[model samples]
Target: MTGARFWDMVCTALYLALYAALYAREIPVPAKRRSVTMSDVAAHAGVSIKTVSNVINNWPYVTEETRQKVVAAIEAVGYRPNHTARSLVTGKTKAVGVLVPDVSNPFFGTAIRACEEALVEDGYSLFLCNTNEDAERERYYLEQLLSRGVDGLILWGARLSCDELEGIVGADTALITVELGEEPRRSNHTCINVDNKGGACMATEHLLREGHRRIGHLAGPLDRITSRQRKQGYEQALVTAGLEPLPEMTVAGHPSVQGGFRAAERLMRTQKPDAIFCYNDLMALGALLAARYLGLRIPHDLALVGFDDIDVSSIVEPPLTTVRIPQAKLGRLTGKVVLERLRGSEGSERVILCPVELRVRGSSGNSFGEEQKKATLDALISSFSDGGERPA
Candidate 1:
C-alpha cells in the first residue's frame, strides 16, 4: 500500500477502536416497558372492563369480592389509568387555575407555593397565570383557563365586577377570590381575605397609644378593597381617638416604594405628621428612605409603620413595625375550598377571613418619653402649621 493510504487505514482503525470502547462504556437503553392498561388488569382478574371501571370509579353497585379482586389485579399490574381519558369520561380536568396580580411580590409568591402544595395532595395540578393587575389581562387569562377546562379558579385581588364574575361562575366552574372582600350583598363566589381594616386599625392605634396624634397615612390606590379598607381603619382609629383625620395627613398612591415616597413627600411638605402608616411594607420602605433623606429621625421625629410583614421588613434599617398576615394559610385555604367544590360539594360560596397582628419594632418607638412627650407633640403641631420649606 502507498504511505498515505497506509496512514489513513491506521487512523481509521484507531478511530473505530476508540468508538467501540466508548460504546462499550456507555449504559445500554432498557427496552420501553408498556404501561399496564385496564383491559390487561381486568383479563388477569377474570372480570369485565366495565366492572373494573366501576370499581375504579367507586360506584356503589360493585360487589365487595369483585372490587377486591379488581384492586388486587390493578396492584399486581401496577396499572395507572390515563388521567386524560378519565377526565374525558368524567368531564373534569382535576385542575385548578390561579391568577395572581404579581408573582414576584413576596406575598403572592408565598401564596402560590402554598396553593400548589395543597392542591397536589388532592391529585390536582395548578395552572398559574400572572395578570400583572391589569383588568383586561386578568379577563383574558380567566377565559383561557375556563376554555381549557380547569375545574376551578382562584383569583388574587380580582378587579372584575359582580356581573362579570357571575357570568364566569356559571354551572360547573367554582371561583374564589383571595385578599379581596366581596361587594355589598354580592354572594356568588367564595372569598379569602386578610383583615385589612383590623390590621390598619391595630397599626394606627399602636401609633395613637404611643402618643402620635398627628399621624399621616401613605395610602394605596383607592380602587382596591385592601387600600380602601385600610384607609377606613385609619380614619376610624383617628375618630375614635377624638382626632380628625386631616386631609393633609393622607396621600393616595400605588402600593410601591415610589408611591410611598411621593405620598410622604406630599405630607412632609404640607404638614409633618408625627407618625406615618403605609399601606404595605414596600411603601413603608420607601417612606423610610424618604424620611432619612429629609433628615428626620424615625420614631423620634416621625414614627413609621407598614403592613405586610415580609421578610425584608425585618432586615431593613430600624426593622419596620408592621402587620403580619397569614399569606400562605390564605392560599392553602383557598385551594382546599376549590378542591371541595371540585369534589361535588355545592352551597353558598365560602368566605375565609384570615387574621392579622401587629409586629412591634424600632420604627414605631417610644414616642412618649418622660421629658420629651409633651415637647414632641407641640413640635409636631408647630411643624404642621409652620408651612416650612420641604426637603428638595
Candidate 2:
C-alpha cells in the first residue's frame, strides 16, 4: 500500500479506538481519565474493556448481563461507529454506486432495480446518482463515490470523456460501464451494451419488408455512441435494398418522448417520409403523436417501428412494433460482473452485447393480420355491450 493509504488506515484505526474510549468513561477523576474511553464504559459496567468491545462489535461472546451494561453505557454516552473510518481500514464499504442518465426512463428504472436486487444478495447496498446526461456531474459523482470507498461502480456514462474514464482505470476501481462503448483508453474498464445497430437494422428491415421505400429516422443525439450506431444501421438497411438513404430524412433528438415529438413533427412538415424508425420507444411514441396530428393513420398512412420494447409499447392505440432488449437481464449480468471483479478476478476488460428481438405489431404493419383479428374481437366485445351477442 502507498504511504498515504497506510496512514489513512492508521488514522481510521485511531478514530475507532478513540470512539470506543469515549463511551467507556467513569465519574470525575478528570486527570486520570484522558477524555472518555471504552475503559470508562467498562468501569461503569464493572467489567473489562474487552467486554465492552465485544458488546460494541456484537461479538456474541459477552454474557447477557455484561451486554446489557455495555448497551446502557453506550446509550448514556451516545457512541456511534464511524463508518467512513472503518471502511478505510478494511478497504470495503459493502456498497456499490450506480450512475445512470435519466432515471425517469422506464428502461433505466428497470435496469436499476435489477442491479439493486442482484447486489442485495451479496449484502451490498446501492447508491444511485442521476447524471442527467452531463459529463461534469458524472465526474463529480465518481469522485465522491470513490472517496467514500464504494466496493464497485456500475457506470452508464454515455457522456463521460476518455480522460475521465482513464482516471477511473488509474484508480484501479472495479467499474462496469453499461450502455456505452469501449473506453478509448488503456483502462481495465469492462462494458455491457445492447445491440443498438443490430436492433435498428432489424427495425428498418421490418419496415422494408412492408415495402416502405422512403423510411425516415428519428435518431438520438449523435454524441451518444448508440445513437450513431443505430443511425448507421438504418442507412445500411436501406442501402442493402438498393435504395440510397436520403440525408434529409433523418432528424436528431434527445432520447425522450418530447424530443421525439418535436423531431418527428419537424420531419413530417418538411420531408413527410412514408415510414419512420425511431431510436427508441419514447421517440417512437412521439412520432406516433406527430403522425396523428398530420391526419395520418398508422401503418395505412405512415408505418413506424421503434427500439426498446418498453412496457407501453404493446398498450398504445396501435401496438408498436419494437426491438425488445433484455434490460433487467443486462442489469443482473452487470452486477455479477462487478461482484466477480471485486472477488479478485483480474480478467481483461470484456464487452457483452445482449441480444434483442423484433416484436411486430400494428405500428409496423402487423406481421400475421393480428391487428385485423384483434379489431374483429374488439367489435364482438362492443356488440355485446350493445346487447347483441351475435354479429349482425
Candidate 3:
C-alpha cells in the first residue's frame, strides 16, 4: 500500500479507538427517584387513597386485615406520610411544647428527659425551649409555641401568669404548669406544685430535732412562689419549735451554686447558724464548698441540708441530705395528664401536690454538738473548684 493510504487508515483507526474509549468512560445519569407518597402506597396495596389515609390516621373503623395490607404496602414502597398534610387534615400538630427555666440545671434536665420519653411513647414530638427565668424570653417562647400550634404545653417554673398564658394559648391546647404561681384556679389549666412549704418544714424540723438551735436558710429568688412557699414553711417550722425566724438568718440568692456560695459565706459570717438549709441541691453543694473553704467540717461544725435530691447529691464526698421531690415522676405525671387532656379524657382544672421525702445523708449530723473529725475536703474541691481564691 502507498504511504499516504497507510497513514490515513492508521489515523482513522486511532480516531475510532479514542471515540470508543470516551463513550465507555461516560456514565449514564440515573433518573431521580420520586419520593414515595401515600398515593403510591394505596396504589401498591390495591386500596383507595381514603383507605390509606384512614389507616395512617389510625381510624378505628378500618378493618385489621386492611390495616395490615396498607402497612405492608407502606413498608414495601417506603412511603412516609406527609406530616404537614396529615396535621392540616386532622387539625392537630401532634407536637407538645415544654418550657423550662433552665435546661442546663439537672433538676429541669431530668424532668425534660422523662417528659419527652412519655410523650414520644404516644407518638407525640416534644419542642423544648429554655426561658432562662426571664419573662420576655418566656413570652417569646410561648408565642412561638402557640404559633406552631402545639397541641399541649408543659410549663416548668413558668414566669408567665395563667391569664397571660391563656391569652396566648388557644382554648383547644392542653396546658400543664409545674411549680407555678399561687393562683388557685386558672380554670383552664392544670397546675402541679412540689410541696415546697412542706418540704421546707420537714427540713427545718429535722434540723431542729438534730438539736441545731440556730438554722439559717439560703433561699431562692424571693419573687418566685416556690421560694416564698419554702420560706413560709421554714418560718412555720421555726415558730412551731418555739424559735424565732429571724430576718437576718434568711438570705435570698439566685438558686445556683455561685449564688449559694456567696449567700452561704454571708450567712455564716454574719448569722453564724449552726445548721443551714438550702433551697435546692445546687445551692447546698455550694454551701458545702463554702463550709469547707472556711475550715468547718460537715455535720460537726455546721450541719447542712438541701432540697431536690438531684443525682449529683448522692455522689458528693458526703451525700447531701435533701428533700426528694420525685422529679422524674413529676415529669411522667405531667406528660400523662397532658396526654389525657389531649385525648379528651381529662377536662377538670385542678392542682396536684406531689409528695416529697426527706433523704437523710451524711451532710446532716445525727445529733447536735458532736465533734466529728472529717477529711480535708480536697477531693471534691479539686473535682469542681475553678482554682479561684475566695474574695478578700
Candidate 1: segments with Cα more than 4 A from true spot: 1-81, 183-188, 346-349, 366-392
Residue 14 lDDT, candidate 2, scale 0-100: 96
How are the candidates ranked when ordered by TM-score, highest leading? 3, 1, 2
Candidate 2, run of 10 with poorest lDDT? 383-392
Report lDDT (Cα) of residue 229, candidate 2. Answer: 89
Model 2 lDDT vs. the true structure? 0.81
Candidate with maximal TM-score: 3
Runs in model 3 lying further than 4 Å from the true structure: 1-32, 184-187, 346-349, 366-392
Residue pairs in candidate 3 whose N, alpha carbon or C atoms collide under 3 angstroms: none
TM-score of each: 0.74, 0.74, 0.84
Best prediction by lDDT: 3
Expressed as tens digits, the lDDT of each residue in 24-57 for candidate 2 is 5664654663446777777877888888877765
Q: List clashing residue pairs in candidate 1.
A: none
TM-score of decoy 1: 0.74
RMSD of 3: 9.7
TM-score result, candidate 2: 0.74
Ranking the candidates on lDDT from highest down gives 3, 1, 2
Give the Cα lDDT of each candidate.
0.81, 0.81, 0.85
